[model samples]
Target: MPRLMLTDEHWSKLRTILLEDRVYDKPEHRQTMEGILYRMRVGCPWQDLPDTFGLWNTIFRRFLLWTRKGILQRLFKKLISEPDFEWIFIDGSIVKAHQHSAGASSKYDEAIGKSKGGNTSKIHLAVDSYGLPIEFTITGGQPHDSKAAKPLIDMLPYANYIIADKGYDSEAIREQVRGRNSIPNIPRKSNSKVGNDDIDWCLYKYRHLVENTFEKLKKYRAIATRYDKLKANYESMVALACIMCWLPM
Candidate 1:
């Protein structure tokens, strides 16, 4: 078989969650998962998958079923049940969407939009103190960072301080953060009446952690540029990437 991404220990942790109530061969399940990971890592078309992982169509269909069931998202949530919430960092990044990512059925928004960069999608992430991603939301690239701030903040697990850059410098965002009883460490815009005195310059330095998280996430070619026509599929790709980050911790 092609080199596997998950070691025995890692597979042990995931098998229960991934295989629950599934009536397939356990060993084949691992191979199917590794095949999916290979596609995500290499950003290859499903038809390009190697023979060792079984029929490409089977693996691709399983991925679609899992995405529809939210299995990957649930697994990520389960792994992050116990998180370090002292300092939460939030940020958004734009990913250029490949031409193939367009032309999806219109049942749901694909989260792709036309921008200066051509078709694009924005991923808004919330990371914990250790720079581990806890939650994220996908939007059209045209939306401002402040537009996603409230929803991202709302998903956070009880953080002591929420750190962000000036893009999230709106009073409404700060008030929302304050409403959650978390201190807002976002820097105020220069012309704003609010002074930077209340800002925690020290903790603000750690805001780079979220940027770093984005860097690591974008390392996966599939994530660097959108390939899936469906937003749910792309979101599952991201959830899997986030879970991989936690696996080593």
Candidate 2:
């Protein structure tokens, strides 16, 4: 038997969500989900998935339907109905895209862009105090952090602090965070007249929690490197990985 990624407990929780979403009622639901996980864990082409999980084309079709309907990300957002909001961290990570990631039909270039690192995409992510994902946005590799920071800052519930790095040290972001009743704990750039004197070094250090979340999610090679030609599909894979992270909680 091939090794499986989801534990019994993980399947139990996920199955409930899938049922509530009314995606499928077949007995093979567990195998189907496992098939997708297997593809992600091994970072293999969909055609190359092992047979123990059933025909890979069938599983890929199911996954396609889920992404088309936004079920994957909807499930992720559902899991965060309650979270520790003492400190909210927002950051972006660049994921290298395979040459195959290009050539989507979208006029917007499908969130893929050419950066200094060559073809790439960026995941603008926010995590809660405990380093669990809260919400995220996908953008071309070169969009500035502040460009994505507004919606994320506006999404969180009122918290003691919303933290980020110097890259997010714009006045507009600070004002927006304060508008949501949370203090911005970002550090100033080196040349700024308003230095980081008021910054809480203790809390700022914890921004690693967001980086840690990225580290954990990237363990799935499919996530570490972009393979899906469509941005929506790639984002679904990332959402599934985030769900896996929440499963252990």
TM-score of each: 0.96, 0.95
lDDT of 1 by residue, 64-167 (tens): 99898898898888778567899999999999999999999778888998977799999999999899999999998899999878888888878899989999
Candidate 1 regions with alpha-carbon error over 4 angstroms: 19-25
Clashes of each: 0, 0
Global local distance difference test of model 1: 0.89
Model 2: per-residue Cα lDDT over 1-249, one tens digit each? 778888888788777887899867688989998999888888899999889999989999999999999999988877665689999999999899988788887765588888777988888889998999988878878888888888777667788999999999899999889888789999999999988888999999999999999998899999888988898999899998899878878
Query: Which pairs, if any, clash in model 1?
Result: none
The 10 consecutive residues of candidate 1 with the worst lDDT sum are: 18-27
- Model 1's TM-score against the true structure: 0.96
Q: Which segments of model 2 are wrong by more than 4 Å?
A: none
In order, candidate lDDTs are 0.89, 0.88
Please report the candidate that would top lDDT against the real structure: 1
Distance from true location, Cα of 14 in model 2, Å: 0.9
